[model samples]
Structures are given as C-alpha cells and as structure tokens.
Target: MSNKKMSGFTIVELLVVLSVIALLLSIITPRYFGKIKEGQEVVLKQNLATIRHAIDQYYSDQGMYPTNLNSLKEKRYLRDIPEDPIMKNQEWQIIKAPNEVGVYDVKSRSNEISSNNNMYSEW
Candidate 1:
C-alpha cells in the first residue's frame, strides 16, 4: 500500500485553532467596545452643538432665549427635543431662569457616562 497523509485536521488541531480564535476575540473585544463608547461620545457632542445652535437661532429670531425647553417646540424651532441617544430617551434637563428672564439652559437629564467617564449631561 502507498503511504498517504490525511488532509483533514485532527481533533487536537481543531481544538488548537478554536482556542486561538477565542484568544484573538478576547484581545479584540475590549478595543471594539472602547470604539463604540467613543462613537457615542462624538454623537453626544454633535447633538449638544445642534441644540445649542438651535437655541441661539431661536434667541436671534425671538429676541431672547426660550423660557423653557417646551417653548422651543412650541415655536417650531425644533420638531421635538432630540432624544439623547446615550441617555435612552430621558428628558433633557432644562435650567430656566428662576427670575423669569426667559433664558434657559438645556442638558441631558440622564447621567449617562461618556467614553471619558464624563456625564452626558455635563457635555
């Protein structure tokens, strides 16, 4: 009989391959998770900028900042307050002037942590 080598991988060889794949995944997963966190932070910053710009424009047109976040919606400045993606639909924090001066500061209501560990509300 002619000597022939088997082409199929042995069970031991297969196990080694699987183990290597698992090791690689373990090394890579955390990096991917970190990237996802960073992406969320970028999105939050963009949302913040958009809201700030809308507020500025509203102030420019109406001669003052909105008295409350609802006023922005009432005046048709924004379709609705954009949901804070990181915060999972939590209502934004609205800081209205206690003295009734008609200026409001808006921020996220949820304490969602950013990639840098800063709260989304503080962004």
Candidate 2:
C-alpha cells in the first residue's frame, strides 16, 4: 500500500477553532445575560402594573384597599397572586397609605437592580 495520510484538522487547527469559539462565547454571553435581565424587568413591571390596577378596581368597588394581597383572592379580584419571577414565588412588597383607600406602593419581591442600578424594591 502507498504511504499517505487522510486529510483532517491538525492539532493546531483544532486548538484554533476552540479558541475562536471560546472568544465568541466570552463576547456574546454578557449581552445574552443582559437581555435576559431586561426581559425579567419588563415582565416584573407588567405584573406590578396589573396588580396595581386590580387593587385600584378593588378599592373602587369596596371603598378601601384590601387588608392584604390575600384579600384580593378572597374577593376573587385575582385568581391567584402572581409570583415574582426573580424571587421565585415570594410575596411582593406592598405599602398602603395610612389613610388612603388603595395601595400607594408596590414593588418586586426580588431585589434585583435595574438597568439604572436601582433596586426593584425601590422602583
């Protein structure tokens, strides 16, 4: 048989390919993570707004904010309380005005910082 070698990537070529892939991943991972965080923030904001609206409506119907979020469920204002994605099913922060009829403050259960570097709790 004739002496010959089948064509295939050399060790150096394989190393180069791996290096390129690692570099690409290093560059892309942070951006992808940032997008995921942004998506979470958007979802959190929407959920908070929805709950706030429901609380307002509850007040309009009943003339006062429920003693607690559970009251919403008792009154069937919501099928169930929406869990905070970041907090993984923890109760959200809720603040009621001393003499007002509805919620004056609502915030995420997760304390994740936003793009502006403000904690979700302070939003």
Best by lDDT: 2
Model 2 misses residue 6 by how many Å?
Answer: 2.8
Model 2 steric clash total: 0
Give the Cα lDDT of each candidate: 0.77, 0.82
Q: Compared with the true structure, what per-residue lDDT tens digits does model 1 show for residues 1-123?
A: 569866888999999999999999999999999888788777767777777778888878987778776787888887877777677673777766566576466777767666667777786
For candidate 1, report its TM-score.
0.79
Worst 10 residues of 1 by lDDT: 96-105
lDDT (10s digit) by residue, model 2, range 1-123: 668968899999999999999999999999999998888888888888878887888888988888888888889988888878778774888898787754655788666678988888876
lDDT (0-100) at residue 30 of candidate 2? 100
lDDT of 1 at 90: 36
Separate clash counts for every candidate: 0, 0
